[model samples]
Target: MTIWTAIFLLLGGVGGGLLSSIASMASLASYPVLLAVGIPPVYANVTNDAALIWTSIGSTISSTKELKGHWKETWFFTIFTVLGSIMGCILLLSFPSSVFEKAVPFFITFSGIMILVSGKHNTLNTEKQPTWLRIVYLGTLLIMGAYTGYFGAAGGVIVLVILTYITNEKFIVINAIKNVISGFANLVALIIFMFTSHIYWLQAIPLAIGMFIGGYIGPAILRRVPEKPVRIFIATLAFVQSAYFFYTAYLR
Candidate 1:
């Protein structure tokens, strides 16, 4: 409620947004800050998804240049993602957090490995993929979509890993594509949470603002940065996320 609290939340948003665009792991920055700022675990996660809508918007707006010809791919993936997100949201409300919390770290670890093996993903000819492979890709996206709706800590990273398998585009382009797809996952969660979950508007406002700013600049940063290091960076974050979640889920 204090001005300082608002300022702090804004700063958290900026950092979350930056990490989101650059690494697909905004929750690494935002989740803890929400907890630090005194939001309960229950509200923080939903609020994070709610504010993240701006991250999607900010990145998409800035991505106009990169997205010039990729609308078809972006929207196509969204269809599966939206359905999965709805399922995820329902599961979140219907199930225990421990269920996904225990599984997410593995998802993160798989994503890290996927990042390392990205070259192989790019070698596949998307156009020539068999119908079964195409189904697998969409199927994976649907499952990942549910993941995004469930906890969604690093949902973008999860999507980024699968995207490489199907799109074969440059990392920058993949980043842009994941932004819209994962953003919809969170956006869909927000829409559902608006009716069912508790969203702390006070923190959500500033967090949204910061993520928007960070998301806008992330794509441009990727455009200039080399892909090798960015891949390493994202993979590293994935491992760290996995380790942290494992500790929380099994150890602590």
Candidate 2:
């Protein structure tokens, strides 16, 4: 790519990573930049996946504090994340995302509202669950993981709501778990995509670099901020993401 294109991608990555680390939405900042640089749609999608790995890496590295006690659960659930991602990757190779894309706006908007209003309901610590309920929870995670493995536009927001509903962990802890596990899911998709020709590494590399920097910085900011403002910020981003995708999926 040209030096200017690299610079633009780098900047895009920074914004994407910052937003991703903070609110689980990166495409809002990075995906359009990939398309703007003239990469084909499928090419941009794969390249976007490649670059996003760095955001997970950067966020995980800096989020050690948030992830501390949650290590066991994170690793345990990541197996399902990997498995679901394999299915998603296989599906993506065979299917057009048009149908799923049509449903994304509603999911994003609903998840956003849930998080915003999730005050007392979300604050409750984990309660003992029955055996059947646990199975249902795992099944849900698998589905969400598959979604993350797919286009992953607002998958994080959906995950944020799901984790909150099931575990009811503190928001920061839930976010940390989401980041680490989602990284593994993306890793599975990356491995599958690596053999394909769609990934434009020239575009992905600079974006990854910028994303890593932003991801590394975001957790530190989150650590000091109060939860309410962060919740509002994420909810707002979700609404914006929902509207943009709505236009792309239907209004257009």
Candidate 3:
């Protein structure tokens, strides 16, 4: 609530936003920052999601150019994401915190393994994916989106991994659509969190402001950076963070 805290949260938001544009792990950064600033874990997670929601808006705008005539295709996944988010959050709420504690390590390790083994495979598209396989892809996303709504650290990465199988779009475009769908998923969860969970509004306000600016600048930076390295770096960071978070959650 102090001016100093406001300043820090704003800085965290910008950093978080930039990360989001690249990898969708903004929550991993800002959640800890909020906790370090004295917000409880529950409040920190909720507020971080609230702040990062703006990144989705910026990403959606940037992605619209790439999507061109593909909005219809995107909508089907978006609708599933929205519904899955609701279901996921409900599932999360149904469990005790201890359940999340036990599952965090498994979630993180699975994601890390997927990235390490499948990064090369990610380059392949769905030119040959059969109809049944497409259903599997959609189902995976829906299930993962639900997880994202519940405890989304690398939820965007989960979507990215799945999408790499279905389309040959540029990673940036895939990331942008992931943002929109995940944003919608989080939006629904945010509404529920506001009612059922504690939210650190004072922290979120500054973070949201910073994220707005960062999200706007991320794509331009991406254009200037080398693609393969950026993707590799992000994947590495996500894996490391997931490991750390899982470790911490397990110890709790």
Candidate 4:
């Protein structure tokens, strides 16, 4: 790889990791960088997925305080997420990318609205969760896993929003769980992608290194910032990203 390409990817990884940790929108940073560096869209997507495994590692380590008592739930959800990611990988390999590209903006916009609405309410914390609610949560994770494994633009935001409504925990804790689940789901997909010829290893390596550093820094920043502002910032970012994707997919 050229020195300039490596530098770009490393910088992209750092930015992607920070965003992924803060907003769960790692792809928004990394994917475009890949494209700008002249990687094909399909290869860039897979390469980005592979590199994101490092983000999970960094996030998991940094968020351990919040994750302390959540191990059982974490493992429980991970199984389903892994399954969903595998399915998503299969779909990506088998289907046309256009179908997902068309649907992404709507999904991102809906997820952002859900996060905003959920943040304003106390329903998730006050009410006793029923068995049905647990089932619903599981279902949401499965779907999110598949989505993250496939297209993955703002998949973390979607996961965070669902967790917000289902769990009574603080937003930071929910975000920590989101990181674990996202990491594992992507791990499954990365393993699958390892066998494929699509991953651009030259780009993926530098990106992974940068993301690892960013992931470690992300939770530290979260801990220092107030929760409300972080939520607002992430929600706004989601909406803006959604609009940009919409314009690119249809208007452009």
Top candidate (TM-score): 1
Regions of model 1 farther than 4 Å from truth: 120-122
lDDT of each: 0.87, 0.85, 0.76, 0.87
Model 2 lDDT per residue over 132-240, tens place: 8777877877887888777677887777777776676678888888888888888888888899546888889999999999889889888899998999999999999
lDDT of 1 by residue, 1-252 (tens): 888988888888888898998899888888888999999988888888878888889999999888889999999999999899999889988997677788878888988988888844446778888999999989999988888787676778878888888886777888899999888888888999899978999889999999999999888898888888899999999999999999998999
lDDT of 4 by residue, 98-171 (tens): 77888889998998888877878765542577888788888988988898777777888998988787778888
Show model 4 residue runs off by greater than 4 Å: 125-127
Output candidate 2 Cα RMSD. 1.5
TM-score of each: 0.97, 0.94, 0.90, 0.94
> Which pairs of residues have clashing backbones in candidate 1?
none
Query: Pairing residues by index, what is the TM-score of model 2?
Result: 0.94
Q: Which ten residues in a row have the lowest lDDT in candidate 1?
A: 116-125
What does candidate 3 score in Cα RMSD to the true structure?
2.1
